[model samples]
Target: MGRKLEENLNFGETESLGIAMEKEDDEIYGIKADEMKKEKRKKKKIKGEEENQNLDFSESKKKKKKKLEESQTIEIPEKKKKKRSKAEGSSEEGNGALEILEEKEKKKKKKKGSGDGNSLENGEQKHGKEREEFEANGAVVSGNDTKESRYAALTSFVESGLPDEVLECCKNFRRPSPIQSHAWPFLLDGRDFIGIAATGSGKTLAFGVPALMHILRKENRKTSKRAVPLCLVLSPTRELAQQIADVLCDAGKPCGLKSVCLYGGTSKGPQISALKSGVDIVIGTPGRLKDLIEMGICCLKEVSFVVLDEADRMLDMGFEQEVRSILSQTSSARQMVMFSATWPLAVHQLAQEFMDPNPVKVVVGSEDLAANHDVMQIVEVLEDRARNDRLVALLEKYHNSQRNRVLVFVLYKKEAARVETMLQKKGWKVVSVHGDKAQHDRTKALSLFKEGKCPLMIATDVASRGLDIPDVEVVINYSFPLTAEDYVHRIGRTGRAGKKGVAHTFFMQENKGLAGELVNVLREAGQIVPASLMKFGTHVKKKESKLYGAHFKEIAADAPKSTKITFNNSDDED
Candidate 1:
């Protein structure tokens, strides 16, 4: 039993030794695996180092190439600078420098042409320059020896060659406007004159003074039994005619000359009585004057001086026939004078038919349609539904005090009434003058507006042209006009008498047709145009004739009428 126990212990010891040997083999293999992993790590590190070096080398090469390119670009301008320096003394080098500048300009132009936005910006810059030039020159004179006879602008009222009485009447005026200064020399000299100027440029006094002078110079006026007028002034609207009469009467009162305003919408009894009593000047609209002339109550036999004010507006209002009839009744040797804010085709035609061949045409600004520079035009492009809110906002901003005179122009008569009612409901003091309103009411509204009794007035195009409301601070276009000319005249109600004004216009998709013209006007006046408006496109569609549609051919106003040739056939003669 003792021997068996010793053998079992030895067997157990042998088993323990075998287990220790297996453990030692496992450790040896573990060390080998660790060494293999270490070598692999070293290889990866070497490969990474090589790749980093290559990348750094490539980056350095790229940097050198960039630096070389930059140096080349920098050296070119330096060489040009050297050339410019040499060109100062050498004509040949100067030509080279000029060529270089020309190339640069060409490149710039090319770049500008590469984008539509840039091209539009260039156009704006060009228009801005044109406006600046016009403003700087003050007036543009054309026709009939303009170079020699163009009168120097009157610096003060004293320079105006007016009788003492007339000068006394003008004492309140600070200075003559540009139109008055330029037109006075021609008109007072008894020359047929065409004065094209912006509205509110003091055209009334420009022609009124000359008419008074014409009447005053006549020698046989004192002993004549006839009560015929010697001078006639035709206006487009009754309001303008009344305004002209007031001015002429006030001016002529100092000269012992009586003036009568003959217009419709008022009792004819008073007009006829005033005419029968004797008057030096007759100012009336075409329709009323034609009626009176046809009725034999008013006569134009002694009318030697005829003036058509706002001639374009009159022609636009279909007064051409009446105007021709009135002109035909006037003395053939009458001195014809026409003052227009625009030189449209129809106005040109009338001038051709009536005015002297060499009438002096004086344009105060550009002949093209342009807004008053004194007025700041703000155009907002918004949805039609948003107009009410936007208009309210603009009113709150522009007419906050509501003491200043603000004229709101709408498209239709009902729109005017609607807007007026809307403002009235908003707790605003507003008066409206539209066609739907009676003539008496219109006159009263205008009187109230002029007197500052009513600070706000809403009207259609009736009040747009030639209604000189003093101290009108703002004009808002609630609806765009059918024509751009009306738009100009509407805003022209403000910015009068050399005073600055503001015009806020609400534009919608419906007004896209006029967007181009509006943009042009704004750019010409150096006003900002919104991008949203520009998106409507800058193409101005040709105006279609109301009667002739798109196939109408626009003939020049000065073009001679085509003669209807009658063919005489030989067979018929035989």
Candidate 2:
């Protein structure tokens, strides 16, 4: 029994030892599996990092390639860019002429092709031939072409005899205005010219510069002791004559050219003396000039260039016969240049009589009688009784404003005087100019107004045309003008030298006739037309009713000749 118990104990110990060894082997196998899994994860992570680095390198290369490409392209210099922009601007200013001509040509061609051409192919071929000829003439039909382009080409090839001094003067005076740009070349080429540019558009300089150059270039011209003038400029008014003389003299100062002004208001003795002292250029009004020419003090036989400044105004002032007489006296070989703001039938007749058969017709903007676009037209409808109060209010407002120069226009000289007295009573520094005022007083008033000593000026139509008072901030029409043309000239006083301006017109029910034309002018200028004005555009039709005082009602032809006259009578019958 003792031997059996010992065997059983030995068997139990062996079995327990076997179980413990099995557990130890399982734990070691689990740890080895975990270590292998960690190694695989680390290898995958390293591969992902390499792929991300490759993508980053590729993106950097693309950016560098784009930069290199950009650097390879040519860049325009700043100075060249500015010059190109200037050329483009001039091209735009003069492009209207080319556009109009091409459009007309196109319409003609289209009509020809549609109606009587041989065939579509033949018509197209003909059109192409015409285009080639057109281009060969240096008139490129670009969508962006300009008549100035053709003129520029022609000028380069055709020998423009412009003096270096004149060219230098123009450069220093600033690039040519639209009128000068177009008219200068024609005038410089010694071609007769009829330029229709708006007032204050530098017409003085447009004609003056060319006249000076012509006089300076004359052969064997003595500086002193000359009885006859080389060039003659005829103007409508004394003020305008003086202004023209000043412009010509200033422009010709560089060329050592002498200019003198002759007008009726100033003493004739001084003018006679100036004429005797030998003047290269003579600018004068019709009345004074006619007297001087009749007295044999001034002669036009030597005059090579003649400019009728404000030609339309001269005709309007009944200087037509005088102008004809003067032009008839001038040498037929003289280059006749007429610069008018309007193109009336009379002006056309005058041009046909005096100018070359095919004179250079340079018209900036429209030739129709219209106000300057640079001036903002602000029409205020008011009762006749409210005009005074409104005028005062406007003056008071602008009196304290930074822009102080203001000009007020009236229909009558008496009204101008009354307004001046009233404004003066109101403690405003004001001046008056009219037909009744002496020339000295008129000159004094203009001087004071120009110097800003008198910030406000009241004047009749005498101050309307050819007055160049720079920096005039506003123009006030206290009364309606005699005509649409007059209205244009009045507002043109403020907006000079390409500067912006404002015009305030005091309108009344009596001025209804002007509303139609005024609305058209306002609309064409891209201004804000009042709703009140819109009604007049379609309603009012009478042209003479706005300006002239109401005359006797027109009697029907069949009616009695002595029928009772009802409307207000105009004093013009006297």
Candidate 3:
């Protein structure tokens, strides 16, 4: 029994030991499997890093290549630009005129070719031809079909196509002035017209005869008892208005057309009475006319013809709003006529607004700012205080006899009165006209000046524009006016009606801003510019505005307005 028990215990011990060993082997196998899997994972990571490095290197090479190509492209254009600029410089220095002539010849050839749909080129050729013709005529005309619309300049009053009565009125005029000759046909054709000529160029008669003809042709024309003005003329100054009224009255008298003049600083009572009494034509300044129109004493509803004489001056005098209001009261289909000494941008804007889109524009001289070529412009640099002695000397030299008219212009109303006093003290027969004077006094002064009774007249810029005193042998500028344009007008006071006259201008240091423009004007008119004036650089500064100063942009009236843009926060976030 003891031996059997010992054997069984031994077998159980063996089996138990076998089971423990099996568990140990299994643990060892699991640890080896984990090590192999970790090795495989490490190998995969190394391969991924190597591939990523290769891709980075290739991408870097591509970027470098692109940069080099871009640099080459930029350099090529730079080199070409340098060559082109050098060529241009050489051409400008050597053969610019030859190039221009060759280009013109090419254009002429192109113009002779078949009429294609190239309207731009054709229009340019037409403009060139018109410019040539205008140069030949000693005038410059620009508009659509100006050549076709323009009539041959009338050499004789008989060819004026005017009524015998009207012709008789112009019998004293040796022949039509340049402006009258060119503008008569267009006006008589009942087309909208813009006449640009110097002052005293017979612009009054140019429009007057046509206006009279227009009125006479109206079958329903009212009689003197109930006559409403069929024509309206607007002037800038009261003097100009009165002058235009006088001319129209004389011309329309043979036709039994009564006219009335309306202006401020005078008795509106007479003007109102004349309106009530019935008139065929009404000539007035903007302010008084606007007052009369608003007062319901005047009616322009029947007016079929309108004239804006000295339109630029009217605008310059801040009469644009009043002029616009007056024109608004006239007939919409009215034949609009604008006669101005200058074709300024303001005048152009006004024409665009009121006149016909394709009106016949006749420029008797250059469209640029120009003085009357008949006037001899003499500029003298002197101290402001020295002007008195210089003026006395000039008067002695040019106005010693004082039989012919001598107009003296000053910068200010105070200066006009002071100069008049000085001249009076010097025992000179001088009368003064300025804004300070009463309308009656001014009228009397002008009458005396025109009649050559007081041949020496001291005045301000108010008399610079559109004052026609025949035989004004000399004009002396006691001081430069506020603008170069006014300087031109001041000199233009003399040398009118195809007569030679002299202008003596005194320039001071304060007027250096206009020195360049004055030089250009002198060169254009074939006058000599002083060396002292040329010391001021020939740079024309842009015109600054009174309201906006340097910030003012001279944008076109018809330029497109800027658009506003907005960004949404949500769009940026997206």
Off by over 4 Å in 2: 1-150, 153-161, 401-403, 534-574
Q: Give TM-scores for every candidate, taking all chains together and pairing residue i with residue i.
A: 0.73, 0.67, 0.73
Relative to the unseen true structure, what is the C-alpha lDDT of residue 122 in candidate 3, on a scale of 0 to 100? 40
lDDT of 2 by residue, 354-459 (tens): 7754455555655444677788899887888999999999887766663489999999989988999888788777889888888889989998888888768899
- Steric clash pairs (candidate 3): none
- Reference-based lDDT, each prediction: 0.76, 0.70, 0.76
Q: How accurate is candidate 1 locally (lDDT)?
A: 0.76
The sequence of per-residue lDDT tens digits that candidate 1 reaches over residues 378-464 is 998878788777777877887788778888899999998998888889888889998788778999999999998888889999899
Which model, 1 or 2, shows the larger TM-score? Answer: 1
Where's the lowest-lDDT run of ten residues in candidate 1? 127-136
Model 1, residue 423: distance off in Å is: 2.4
Candidate ranking (lDDT, best to worst): 1, 3, 2
In angstroms, give how far residue 161 of model 3 lies from its true place: 2.8
